[model samples]
Target: MSEVITGGCLCGAVRYRCTAAPNNVGLCQCERCQRQSGSAFLMATVFARDAVEFERGELKVFAAFDDDGQGLYRHFCPTCGSAVMITLDRYPEIRSIMGGTLDDKSWLKPTYSLWTSSGQPWLVLPPGIRLHPDYPDGAVA
Candidate 1:
């Protein structure tokens, strides 16, 4: 089995652990993601919600609608102001961990990229990963 992925916020106010290996990892260049991450793009990893647990700190959320008008919830650390995770409020069974929060970033390379149309020219994506101008079919996987 893959070793559990564990991490926390900058101030340790929020901590999380996921027993399931990430089924997908990718970068998102949607405007909201760009703004929230305060960078060129937002990197993310998907895991089953049943596989993740919050050891401490409550998650603070900002509700927003995604491209499909789904109820998207952006969660972060209240103390450190660090982006933590995001999820669809209606489906709590699947969860995403903000890639920036991983304890060991070496293994968190993105395998795909989404919303590339909104991606800035200043940012250069890594070579050899699938790039989707928008969400692909079965994107939830």
Candidate 2:
């Protein structure tokens, strides 16, 4: 088994653990993500839903559709308002942990990026990473 990945909200109000190895680390630069994250983009590390465990606190969720008209849900800590994870319609079995909330983000390296067309022009994406104009088919592993 891979080493566990753990994280939480900024205020320590919420925490989570991932038993499975995290893969498909990437960013979403869509308008909704930008607005919700209050940042240039949303960085995330993907894992299977069953592999993740909510170790503490309940998350408040906001449901919406992505720019591609796919169902999306954002889970965040109600107290600190820090986004913890997201569920995408394309891969209901997968859950994405917010990169910023990870306790050990030093090892975080995004290998692909979603919604490249909607990405900020000023932000330069690294070369060699897979760039998808929109959601890639079967994006989750």
Candidate 3:
């Protein structure tokens, strides 16, 4: 089995573990993502919904729709207001963990970047990472 990945909210009020390897690790620079993260972009690591197991505390969720009108749910720590995870109605089988919430982020390497059209002009990405003006042509997320 792959090594278990563990993470939690900034306040330590919510904790979780992932047993499966990530399906995708990407950066999102959409306007909504920028606002949600309060940064240039959000680093998200995706895995199967069943792979993530919450070990402690409850998450407060904010539900909204994307620019395309797809349902989006943002889960966070109510105590510290740290975004922890997100779920999409269009991809119910998948869950995305906010990379910053992970206890160990040394292994987190974003392979793709989305919404480059809305990405911050001053931001620079590492070489060879795929860039998409919007969601990748065949990507489900």
Candidate 4:
């Protein structure tokens, strides 16, 4: 990726710029993701922690405990309650941004699907990508 990726919260209270290309792109089918996003799944792209820049405003972070009892921070705009990004304690170097907030997402390609065990039965994922029953093999479980 030659250019930086830009995004922000719904209320425009927070904005971000990512200089480094995303390390991971995928959809998560975990229940927590669905509950937090109020959707069927979480569509996100992960990048190095330092690659993300909060160019406009501050974000409110909610510490949510995962099924494994690990704490993860869900960062969002307090004004709109729009989830912007996330950081897991186990993966401090990685920050996952909500894809829906991206200013340009014409090149997104989800290479994996996480938590397939909890995915909706009607959801048919593409055949080539890795699909995990619970968590991916190298995932912090």
Top-lDDT structure, candidate number: 3
Per-residue accuracy of model 1 over 35-121 as CA lDDT, tens digit each: 999998888888888888999999899999756778888999988889999898556678888988989878776888898999998
Residue 124 displacement in candidate 2 (angstroms): 0.6
- The TM-score that candidate 2 achieves is 0.91
* Structural similarity to truth (TM-score) of each candidate: 0.91, 0.91, 0.94, 0.92
Model 1 Cα shift for residue 134 (angstroms): 1.5
- Residue 25 alpha-carbon offset, candidate 4, angstroms: 0.1
Query: Which residue runs does candidate 1 get wrong by more than 4 Å?
Result: 66-69, 89-92
Per-residue lDDT of model 4, residues 1-141, tens digit only: 449999998989899999989987989899988888998788879989899999998898889886789888888898999999989887887899999999888888888888889988999988897887776656632
Q: Predictions ranked by TM-score, top down? A: 3, 4, 1, 2
Give the per-residue lDDT digits (tens) of candidate 2, residues 1-141. Answer: 338888899999898898988767998887778898998789988988898898889999999975689878899999999999998787888999998998888888888888878878898888988888877887761
Question: Whose lDDT is higher: candidate 1's or candidate 3's?
Answer: 3
Clashes of 2: 0
lDDT of 3 by residue, 81-128 (tens): 999998998789999999999888888888999999999999999998
